[model samples]
Target: MTETARDIVMGRIRAALAAAPPERVEVPRDYDRQPLQGPADVARFAETVADYQARVLRIGADEIAGTIAALLPVGATVAVPGDIPPDWVAGLATVPDDPPLSNAALDATTAVVTGCAVGIAATGTIVLDGGAAQGRRALTLIPDHHICVVFAGQIVDTVPQGFAALNPLRPLTFVSGPSATSDIELERVEGVHGPRTLDVLIVEP
Candidate 1:
């Protein structure tokens, strides 16, 4: 309470602060160099993504509908966003994006396919912004199978690059492969939350 006591306290506080451990920091460069091999980079991205229980597939644009059908069983309802191209749902029971189907209903569906804003090549992250094509967050959460369509042009080289390309104000879901977690013994468990299976269709023009 006294001035001398206050000064001593302040000095002690300063000394404690000075003695504290330094914070670990990561220096983010403007441009992080990607792997020299282009094919290898893509393959590595897919491999790492699959490690999270995500099914990654590279296919031509015209083959999308068929691929979707293959991933989902017959008579299975598929949730398609309002802005999803018609061609994207050629051979499935297309569920409309209105009234926002219940989670229970979504669980009954075979798959939920939506468009992605960006796919990062460096970390194999798929980002959704709740855009017209991506639809609400529930669509992705409730469904067991999530087929995200990522245009080749939308793929970026790195995480920083992807962030710079997107608007932070938007509702964004950054998906780095499928959902998984580890237990006490570091035992891995997949699909406890979010989609258990994430199928990414990289649409190459």
Candidate 2:
């Protein structure tokens, strides 16, 4: 049988690696973790996230469930974490991922709604440490749509500020808008890596 192009390339890569193994270099981590900038900019976060084609909504805490219900398709079933607030998912059909749903199971759900670990205003990024209302990384990845609720207080102005609030030991997944990729010809495709649509609800007082 003839070797495929993929196998040939992989074999050459393996041989090259065996010939000269790369060295491990120490990464520097002495940067300031304090907030060099002022307070977190909620507006900046919203603007940047919207630039990625994500839908960003600012609403009161009381309107979370209602807003979510209205935004989602009628009769949609949402996947949620086990510890998600009861009020956040009120009046919605939900399947909790406490036992950890299979990929197919998660895909069957219309969307995944969860609370985030933190929000970075500088890069319009949402971080999840699998705590609070956030299930495993799979819960958000497998579903076609993800609705992440970020509290105003959780918004940080910079990466350092975001890091200051998080525990590095926990598993972290940073999402900046919906998953999208461009091919060599610049043909844009959505949901290539994760959710095709990302709806961010910013809860304010």
Candidate 3:
């Protein structure tokens, strides 16, 4: 019968593959795996995080709830994961995400509070693995403001170190700073894809 356009394209693709040689390739991975020494450098990390235009506060464990509350506006509605420590957000107007909140509802919320899976001190990146305290990805993305509680113990020196502490199977979100992008003319805009304001509370023992 008739040779259709789809058939012609498939025939050409098959002919091209048959004429190509097959080979196996091996990738080189002899680079330095451990670049940094010891645990995360809190002072360096704070400085790097601040350079990104995000606020960083170092406080004792007892002051966590107060600091978080102070960072948020009065009467603000905060989206929180059910697994987060209750004392961390004590007396705050919080909506739990156990059943998962709708996008519209999350949009209406003023902020979101979460605990990160790991923090990369060298690059000032926060990694979230959709863990119990981190909740789903939508909860952190939809809010205008985000207050993340990061413990010193969870901080790592570099990206490689952070990766070593995380599981590849889980969903990962790495945040370096508040969502921002520059246009062709070099103008910068914030909160385009994520929170405009990121307040990182670095808790020490």
Candidate 4:
């Protein structure tokens, strides 16, 4: 067929598709359901996180501050995000988050505590960003131990579901476990690029 004839045919097909009734399309099935069983899911999630060499703790809301204090040594500096709950570190020697802390300052810090955006159950990942509870990316990277508090409301059953719950505009950091690396000779090492120890506190609402 000539080029002009092919163009005409294509235009007609496009018009026909546009003119078709919307009701002719099949409805997509619903995939968002309670994919997890009661109690079992939460237990499994904690176990999975621990299996990655990360420490996971389930605690009541009232115990948060005490737990944080215990994780950090006395007089040890801690970096806390601006939006972190004040009560979360009521008695700890926490340093308020300031912009562009020096590497020396960070190295001296014992821990960094921040709130997470979401916790993925299937992969046991914690997502964070430079948002309200989570300070700048530096806060997470520089500390030896990272204490992330994940509210139960923020936990999702699957990764796809977690993505759906996240804001596309915000910067996101996905952490599966503590930072580690292995040498060419197969010797394992920890704290190569990020915190060597990750302490996750899953707080119940």
Give the candidate number with the greatest lDDT: 2
TM-score per candidate, in order?
0.80, 0.83, 0.84, 0.78
Clash pairs (backbone) in predicted model 2:
none
Please, what are the lDDT tens digits per residue for candidate 1 over residues 54-113?
Answer: 888989989998988898876888987877888888867899777688778888777889
What is residue 103's positional error in candidate 3, in angstroms?
0.6
Ranking by lDDT: 2, 3, 4, 1
Angstrom error at residue 146, model 2: 0.3
Report the Cα lDDT for candidate 1. 0.81
Q: In TM-score terms, which candidate is top?
A: 3
Candidate 4 lDDT tens digits, 118-169: 8888788889867778988888988899999988877878777777778978
Off by over 4 Å in 4: 1-40
lDDT of 4: 0.84
Alpha-carbon shift of residue 25 in model 3 (angstroms):
10
Winner on lDDT (3 vs 4): 3
Which scores better on lDDT, 1 or 2? 2
Worst 10 residues of 2 by lDDT: 31-40
Clashing pairs in 3: none
User: Compared with the true structure, what per-residue lDDT tens digits does model 2 show for residues 1-205?
Assistant: 3579889999999999999999999999876677646457899999988988999999999999999998899899999999999999999999999898999999999999999999998899999999989989999999999999999889988888888899999999999999999999999999989999999999988
Which is the winner by TM-score between candidate 2 and candidate 4? 2
TM-score (C-alpha) between model 3 and the true structure: 0.84
Ordered list by TM-score, greatest first? 3, 2, 1, 4
